[model samples]
Target: MPHDDFQLPEQPRPYVQPPLPPKRHGTGWWIYGFFAAWICLGALISNGWSINFMVITIVVTFVGTPLLGAALFAATKSDRR
Candidate 1:
């Protein structure tokens, strides 16, 4: 067997990720507040009090209110002295 007959395998290069965009501070609260506001608007529009609309309003309020509250809480917590 000739040594020159077998060529050494090429080395693999390390994986590199592209640079990420800069983070936006305090954006979470704005997003959560936006959704929460939409939910409130929906509830207001459904004030006719139909059963289905009432259920939807309740569900959205249940979910959105907590999310908005959490975001607001986080924003305030981050601002503490």
Candidate 2:
């Protein structure tokens, strides 16, 4: 076909968009709720109530937080696939 005689089709090209990220669910919600509950409970339990506040905080932060995080991570990771 001659250059002048040949014309490209006027139709639009087909396009595809990338898939969106997975929606947040049990993990996200559980994390937020757990943290919030801890803070509120800690405040109520320690403030003006006991002198063992520091010890309680340490145990919760070091032991509880890690356990909770690990559980959430495992649960979420499995759900991903």
Candidate 3:
């Protein structure tokens, strides 16, 4: 196409995403939170006396819960593209 021939089409426009969904409080959230805490507590009881057990449980609680929540959100989100 030549520059002289180029023109912008007059069309409604392409859609743009407004934004990521706002953080929501849903039953799913509570469930995940409870499950994470429960696992954390079990870990504490089962291995609280062991240095390795305590470290592993702390790591899982800190890193695992959010990763699980994000995965849940990603799975449930609508595809906009």
Number of the predicted model whose TM-score against the real structure is largest: 2
Error of 1 at 51 (Å): 1.6
- Between prediction 1 and prediction 3, the one with superior TM-score is 1
lDDT of 3 by residue, 1-81 (tens): 665455545434544434434333342675567566867686767765577766666677667767876776666564433
Assess the local accuracy of residue 41 in candidate 2 as a C-alpha lDDT between 0 and 100: 76
Whole-model alpha-carbon lDDT for candidate 1: 0.60
The lDDT, on a scale of 0 to 1, for candidate 3 is 0.61
TM-score for candidate 2, residues paired by index: 0.51
Give the per-residue lDDT digits (tens) of candidate 1, residues 45-65.
887657766677667777777
Q: What TM-score does prediction 3 earn? A: 0.42
Ranking by TM-score: 2, 1, 3
lDDT of each: 0.60, 0.64, 0.61
Q: lDDT (0-100) at residue 80 of candidate 1?
A: 46
Q: What is the lDDT of residue 21 in candidate 1?
A: 20
RMSD of 3: 7.2
